[model samples]
Target: MKQLGSKIRGFFNTRLGFFALAVALFWAKTYWAYQTKFNLGVSGKMQNLLLVLNPLPTTILLFGVALYISGRKSYITMLIIDALTSLWLFANVLYYREFSDFMTFSLIKGSSSVSSNLSTGVMGIMRASDWLVFVDVAILILLLAFHVIRMDTRPIKKLFAVGVTLLAGLMFGSNLSMAYHDRSGLLTRTFDNNYIVKYLGLNAYTVFDGVKTAQTSATKANAKASDMNSVLVYLKKNRIDPNAQYTGVAKGKNVFIIHLESFQQFLIDYKWDGQEVTPNLNKLFHESDTLSFDNFFHQVGQGKTSDAETMMENSLFGLPEGSAMSLLGTSNTFQAAPAIMDQQGYTTAALHGGVASFWNRDNAYKSWGYDYFFSKSYYQNIKNDFLGYGIKDKLFMRQAAGYIEQLPQPFYAKLITVTNHYPYPLDKKNQSIAKTDTGDKTVDGYVQTAHYLDQAIGEFMAWLKKTGLDKTSMIVFYGDHFGISANHKDAVAQLLGKDSFDDFDNAMFQRVPLMIHMDGLKGGINHTYGGEIDVLPTIMNLLGISNKGYIQFGSDLLAANRNQTVAFRNGDFVSPTYTKIGSNYYDTKTGEQLKKLTQAQKEAVDAMTNRVTTELSLSDRVVNRDLLRFYTPNGFTKVDKSDYSYTQSKALEMLQAADDKNKTSLIDKNNGKSTMNEYKTDAPEMAGLKEFADSYSSSSSSASSSSGTTSASSSSATSDSSDKDK
Candidate 1:
């Protein structure tokens, strides 16, 4: 075999061999998955393990198959390179921990963990099955590449030559394609001079890509603060009440707002798998008016659950046009229920089982109007028996009960639960709640947590009954966001059952369990179009509160007038940028894009979109920070220091700091350790300088000197302006 020309040189230059290597090492990735499962530390959840095993193997297969179809050389380095590269891919996914986290059982809970290998194998099977076809293609490529590369003979020389030519062409094409994707700063300077010179009207040979960089920056700058306010005003002119109560919910009620961590809609199906998994939540909706907003969606223009909460609770919209949750707690002020209640004469309190401020929750809540904030420390020293992430629902519930008893007559208290958190790692060691025999993994943990929380809620409600405060109080309960993406898909599949993927069925993620349980309110399923933003106005409407001058994205959940939805892309990287109306997506940034919705429908949707945008901007900029004042779009009469959060550094310098100091806290005494928030909903909330934020949270008078409002707790939603926590 005589080699001539640049054939040998070309083969070495190509990455086809590396692709083959990746395929060979795909099987060995099992060890990585197993190691991550058990040794990810006490804080890690089973879900983290699940996240480890996703998509990498399949990608490895793709690399191998492409190489087999293209390359001429058979090599041992292929396997070695593949394993190393596969590990790299695994590490990246684990670091981001977004899609995978939602897919896996939480490692911290160890609910997904198993002492017995049999159960663990069953889960492993599921993870392995997802990549089976990819593996098959990879193995086939390796054997075939070996046979074809070393083929010998003379009469068959023509066929062999033809095969060789085609293989070389394929390899070259694949490499070129790969290069196209690596268009980073360094890459462009090195590779794409010709294309850059043409499209961008630049000198290809020059290293200065400054003009292109400036243009991209300018486009991003165009996404200004008012984008959020535009949505708010548009909402008033077209959708529900123009002026609605900004905050200050019903007083004296034990408001249990369990943002069921990653609680997706797929979990709600009445698929009594011989027994009901979510029997309590599903059944609760029966006695309560379940605001089953079928067309409602997540206003997540940016982060996942973090974005969902910011959009919903703050009555804000859009992501910060950058990374979501990364800039949490920094927003000066936003419309949170507690903030609203604080304005309308309510002593606000917040409770979550997680760390004090994982996602800047501590500072962010202070901006949201909570007078008292409670996290893991609030429930301190008690057996955090459940896991490293948070205390069990039962423990949280007990604390909530005590807080409720201490609250003034007209008070607001929120309790966010973690029992139903991923991997549903049941702390069955000491809990009194008897576990039901549910064979399904997802169903078992979900049901158990749901049931336990349900019992806790029921006990709380029973206490309210005993105190005689149950009749007048209004309670809002809903899942903050869906639990997992897979659960949402599975639910959609359950509806369609073994068919093509339905984008519309993606509702399980956006559509969650929402209910307003009040003594006088009618009980039944209210299957209207609604979402997180709409909850505020709906509650106000029921209480007969007049919100004539407020600016918010929410409408009365029970109101007859229908409202549309607006969406945000947590980390936007495109145009048409996922801005939408309810479930229907159309790109008419300046006009009504969806013809399916009539003039009224168009108005409703456009208005909502604008409102969501407005609220997001306003909250982000820290407007309407009056703790006692019900904030309107214009209600934010005074700018406080807290409302003007400054521009933060984009990179995680703290991670670098930890590296520099060689000081890390997560190392387990027994094994090892770990962790992960983002948002934007405001009316142009960015401050030119940090000095401007001085007056953000300043309220002139305590509730005592007010024309309306009680000292620590108001008697009711105070009608007087002085009650506003400005």
Candidate 2:
């Protein structure tokens, strides 16, 4: 029986069969459906898709080499590739918004592009069953890779198969364990793409419905049976009315929300040869009601700006453990600002300088309640230089002003700007002097473009003032994330004196500028540490709007009464609180803090986490059913301040302090103060940190020559930043 089985396997693993299959990939037409409903032209989507998948040639080369070397057929390898593609496709589509029509095999099977273009279903792979496709396909790929690769060597094949099967089993078992972990509530499954792909059998990069439905079901079930009320519930228990305290909301006013891409605190720190690069932003900070929360952090990094927007505008967070904004699944369940504002009877619109559907921002904006959406398509003519990502922030803001003017009575407009973005090159080739590289930019070019973008903002402010709209317009501007991640820390350290404060050395990514300007806003810099999550409640307070029993993670910044701002990551809190007077990040459950100077930050984060997760449990039911605006379902509960444990708090403190010490040490090392890491990762933070000492050392290109300072790049201004804007 064994001999016969071996013969059959050997027969199937011939070189000709392998070669035939390898050649077939070229013939197998992969039709990528138009991401946008409006057609660009023939082969437009295909060409763009190929460009997006630019590494394909390298991948094919690798496969070709592998086949030639190991005599492993490319066709056999394709089985693995196919499996992986399907798995990734499944994972990508797992989110409700991302999983459009072609995501389904039925839609893509016969078509040259995808199978379907449908964009309706659950929000994400919330349920546990969502992982099955990837896990199973991954298992098949490995089993087959070993089966084909070792067909010439029987013993090796057997051993490899066994080992792979065991590993897959272990991963599958661990995933099952996580799924069952009660503390994780309904989000304990393998929700992360990295985790699933690394351990599962095989994976495709496709976006399918991840384990979202199962998670929702389980969480809803858990919430239904729970006795605890989250902060929202607690707030309901002890509600406050802003109508009684402050004046009413700005009803007949125009609202401007500027979403700056990759705008982190480090940008200010990273100066262009000892000059504050962002003069306009610096000036705006002084003039605006700057709430400089010392310990504020982005809830979802660069990957989830929309999630941040959702949190900021609507006063809500997505599901506990996943990217609420990732366009993965079919169901459209985004946390939208315009939707809520629409509920308030406000004219709503979103403006950006990129394609409307790049991140499915248009679809997101549809339910987001934007009465109008102005994307790259709407622009009269865009400078399509090295349009790597999107367009200039200046153009976006300029267009946004026009949109705001078009709005009737009280309008809510979200304008996402791209300038001060990554590959922060300040040259003629990139961004038209919007400066792409954070380190060695052609300063004149960058400054010129930045000046232009800043002038745009200032000019808009001037316009508002001249039109008497300043009295009625509420402008909220903030950086989406850190720019380019180079020289930011050094710039900051140089300004603050790396030794000035131990806090700013590390986590420059978390450092962002947030300012709210309006006639009614009490102008002053509130240095209380906070993260992006705090913005929603802060806005609510400024607007004299109550928490609405929905937004629990945010705090009413206007309230003299105490409230905490919380944030989440990987289904748990890094530092949960933002209500503290000073900068510090702490875990509420373990009491293990990140920034230890203040205990208040940890408490606030913990309180916020408790509220957020508890709210999530309750929201599970309504999230799938309700529109984007009506998210925070009531009946949730927040733990009392006393409920926090001490040891957990202290541990977080120690970790944060240690982190601070380590970062300061690195900053010193980078600045010739101490020794540098022998092997540094080519990461944004490290690059930024490294630039502190060797600032602008990488500007060796003659075409991008440097004189007194780094010049702005000639590429699209804020293209990278605009991509992050929801």
Candidate 3:
């Protein structure tokens, strides 16, 4: 042991040994960050290898520069380089905590206005282990100071430095080649920033982001009103006339958009061990007053849920790369649903259980003209209230009932649920059903989490009835994106009882549930092919709102002659007649590959492909160049973002100040009292918390008996048998 220690110390006396040690330490630190801090969706042995090996190339490339310097200056330069690189990583760590995305140069340049609040914001988001980011630097500095690892004063040869640079280049080339082999168009058609950092390293991703940001900036700078000409022409030509049967049916009613996170259409009627996966949702789907679409797909790219939101709100597809909400929605002008509804005398609000900064929603909602944003701070989060992404669905919905009752009548509200998110986890006490035997842990837990979300929805729906909100509101429940990724192909295939999975199966698995329910509207399952992009137009038609002057790329799905081609984010298109996956084509009905296409089939494919390509390209142009700033639809006023604040005090003040008699809030109608008692949940975490409707009514009755008089509000709080599920 003594001899080995002496030999290691002897090697540390050499310059090359010192450089090697520094590079190894940096590599280990970066890999640790990749594993612990970021959710990069690492899968497969190849990806695992890449994750371990990627940082070495970048570390060598950056630190190799110090080797060119002579004597103690080389050691100093290396330490400085190490410190700066580590600082950048730490900055991304902080940024990722808020945005769930990496720090881009564009974001940095745009953060000057918030610099004063940086200290408070940083403190709020700081984790206990965040200090570990600079621990290696401190350790090295201390070691040198204590002379435990002496800094060699020997000069390095220029030839050796040049060789090191070559080695780094070779390693990076190899990594890039492997990544491309695993996922095509990794650089040019970049989808997720996580993929970039996972396949390469943080340093490479930063450089890539810098280049993309510059390109986007240039595009926005040179954009003109004339550039919108092509987009306007395409939309006008493709616009669908609204169906008279559905048009104006929901006009003047409240709008409730319930976002079911990570939900897929297959779960609607699916069964496991003879038990329904989503019994409540299934009932909703089969209800007489619901308009359900079985062919609806969630066409989210790497942005996933945020991409779905962008499409649902603005009829604009997410960027082909990262989240549009995080990258452009904050600054871009949007003729969004909230703004249009606000102009039509409706109060607009967004309710989410997650942080306001997730996907940059706090700023984006304001840009979209939301009058109120009830984010994480608006909810009471206890120890067991949170699970995957944010607050558990049951607790979030129960708490959100109070906020919903505060919104004035004829309101447009969006409630985003996050319990059914990826890497689904549920506590033993909270899980209502058994997990699936899919072998893959992620897929197995997905079923249980989904079941929990369904129960939450059932409870909230009953609450809406108990409070009489259902009488005047139209609730729309839609899945945001797929819960299981393609990485779990074997598990998914097993669940479906299929022999194997392919691109065709993967494409079909993108279908998500879209159910719109009203009090007395005629409803049935519609098989029209559509994606999230079509939601805005479909809802607008039902609300008697004309999207004629808006530059929306989607057609009204209720229209008898509306287009049925649904475009995916990756340039794939699905139609009732055919489905295209990569370069391959298959008959939608027969599921047979089109190896030999007839002339007519070839022509049809060419035409549809052109339309899909043009639409995606135009949408990308709209977001990347911020082209909507150039035009505003008639009867619409551009939103002033400064008029809104999402703080607890400001949101409550706005709710209290609403004095319109014709559009009084639910709380006002209920004698200015809270309606939260109407909501009930079976969540074990909420045990002993007694605000359930039946219990509240029983207590009210007892009080009335003691007082010998019943107030009108108390009398109306009795349980209704009609509200119970039959």
Candidate 1 worst ten-residue window by lDDT: 674-683
Write model 3 residue lDDT over 1-726, tens digit each, in one string: 999999998887677877888888888888898887776767789999999999999899999999999888988898999999999999888766644467767556544422421453466457888778888788778878898888888777899999999999999999999989988888865445777898988999989888987898899989999999889988888878878889889999999999999999989889998899899999999999999999999988756788899999999998766677876767889989999999999999998876677778888888999998887766644446765467789888876776677677889999999888766778899877888897876589888989999999999999999989898999999999887876567999988999998768888998999999999989999999998999999899899999989978888878888878899886778999989875579999888889999999999988888888889989989888898899888888998888888866556656656633443777667765556666777878778655444444343333212231112123222212211211
Best candidate, TM-score: 3
Question: All candidates: CA RMSD in angstroms?
Answer: 17.2, 19.8, 8.3
Q: Tell me the deviation in Å of residue 140 in model 2.
A: 20
Give the runs in model 1 whose Cα sits over 4 Å from its true position.
Answer: 2-88, 91-233, 242-256, 264-273, 288-298, 318-328, 428-444, 487-501, 544-551, 565-726
Report the error of model 3 at residue 449, Å: 1.4
Q: Identify the leading candidate in terms of lDDT.
A: 3
Please provide, for model 1 over 1-726, each residue's C-alpha lDDT reduced to its tens digit, 9 standing for 90 to 100. Answer: 346535643443335433433433453444343333212211134233323433233334334433343233323434444444444434323322323221111111222211222232234224443343245346635644765333211122345435544654564445334334432332332212223222211111122333443443454445445444544455556566522332333433434455655555554644433555455566556675333443354445324555566655655543332222334344343555566665665556667655554555656665665666655543323322334246566555544443344344455667777666555566555333444333435434555566555555565556555545566566666776654443334434543354543333343335567766666555677655556666666665544544455555566666655544433332111112233422344443443335476677567555655544444444443322221223344443322425322111111122123222432111111012110000111112222422212111111011112221111122112212222221
**Candidate order by decreasing lDDT:** 3, 2, 1
Worst 10 residues of 2 by lDDT: 702-711
lDDT of 2: 0.43
User: Model 1 compared with the native: what TM-score?
Assistant: 0.54
Tell me the RMSD of model 2 versus the true structure.
Answer: 19.8
lDDT of 2 by residue, 249-280 (tens): 54455677877665665444245555555666
TM-score each candidate.
0.54, 0.54, 0.75
Alpha-carbon lDDT, every model = 0.43, 0.43, 0.81
